[model samples]
Target: MADIKVIIPAYNEVDSIAHVVNELPKSVSEVIVVNNNSSDNTVKNAETAGATVITELRKGYGYACLKGLEYIASKSKQPDIIVFIDGDYSDYPEELDNVVAPILEDDIDFVVGARRKNLREEGSMTPQQVFGNWLATFLMRLFFGAKFTDLGPFRAIKYDKLKELNMEDKTYGWTVEMQLKILKKKMTYTEVPVRYKRRIGISKVSGTVKGSIFAGIKILGWIFKYSIK
Candidate 1:
């Protein structure tokens, strides 16, 4: 079996972090939850749920995820695959096997757990999120002939391929940035339909006007920047 590790970027997800950690499949060798400067009991709860918690201090999803990657880089034995998931309890954590299967079985470089509309619960995604996904994906198709349908966070990538991408996004643009880089690098990728539900507590990105606007800008900026490059 390939060694796999999970990275979860959490910001003030005290109410839902534990559930997300506890539900992860046991095949994951380590569950690293990077607490993004949460004032609540996020760290404590994640630790109690058997996740190795790290503090990013900086409040960005990408920052927290980078911290987790740094921790893995310091480990004596690195993982074969890295799976990134959100700590909002919206995604079915137990379905991680489905996310990584293509990489393990077919030697695919990347796999995204696409939250198909048929599998998503009502209102799981906000209006802005839906439109933004559509626009960004449509542009990816138009510009690059990419087949991506959703910019879902629940995704997995080969460790070496991930390192080659040199991911540097420190905020809302992380997911799209990865996708764009994958396209530019000509990496093999696939998507697995996954179930999504209303997250526990409010969403940090889609729940606020400021977050929505910034995320939309960041996502579109990555697409357009790559389109011209």
Candidate 2:
């Protein structure tokens, strides 16, 4: 069996961090939670749940993710695969196996868990999220010739290939950055249908009208930025 490590980037997620950590599968060899300047007990709660907690004082999703990657790289024996899951508990931890199964068994490099829209609870996603997904996917297909649905957070990838992607988006652009980079690299990737639900706290991006506009601009800008380069 390939060694698996789960990386969760958390920020002020005290309410859901512990539950998310506890629900992860035992098949995972290690869980690394990067506390991104959280003002709550997120770090303590995650540590209590058996995760190896790391501190990323810099406040950004990319900062936390890069910190986790650094931690994984420092391991004497690096993990064969690394799974990125949100610490917000909006995603189902039980479905992790399905997300990584393709990569593990078939030599696939990446797997994205596409949330089924119908399965999502009411108010779990705002109207802007639905439209944004449509617009972004459409733009990616039109510009980059890449097809995708639901840029959901629950995803898995081979460790070496992730390093090759050289991800560096600092804020809301992180998810789209990964997608665009993987496309540009021509890596093998697939999407699996996964369940979604409302999160314990409000979303930082799509929860507010202003956040939604900024995120939309960033996502579209990245797609076009890479397309023109």
TM-score of each: 0.99, 0.96
Per-candidate Cα lDDT values, in order, are: 0.95, 0.89
Candidate 1 lDDT by residue in tens digits, 1-229: 8899999999899999999999998899999999999989999999999999989988898898889999999989989999999999999999999999999899999999999999999999999999999999999999999999999999999999999999999999999999999999999999999999999988889999999999999998999999999
Clashes of each: 0, 0
Candidate 1 lDDT at 142 equals 99
Report how far off residue 130 is in candidate 1 (Å): 0.6
Q: Which candidate is the best by lDDT?
A: 1
lDDT of 2: 0.89
Q: After superposition, how far is residue 101 of candidate 2 from its true place, in Å?
A: 0.6
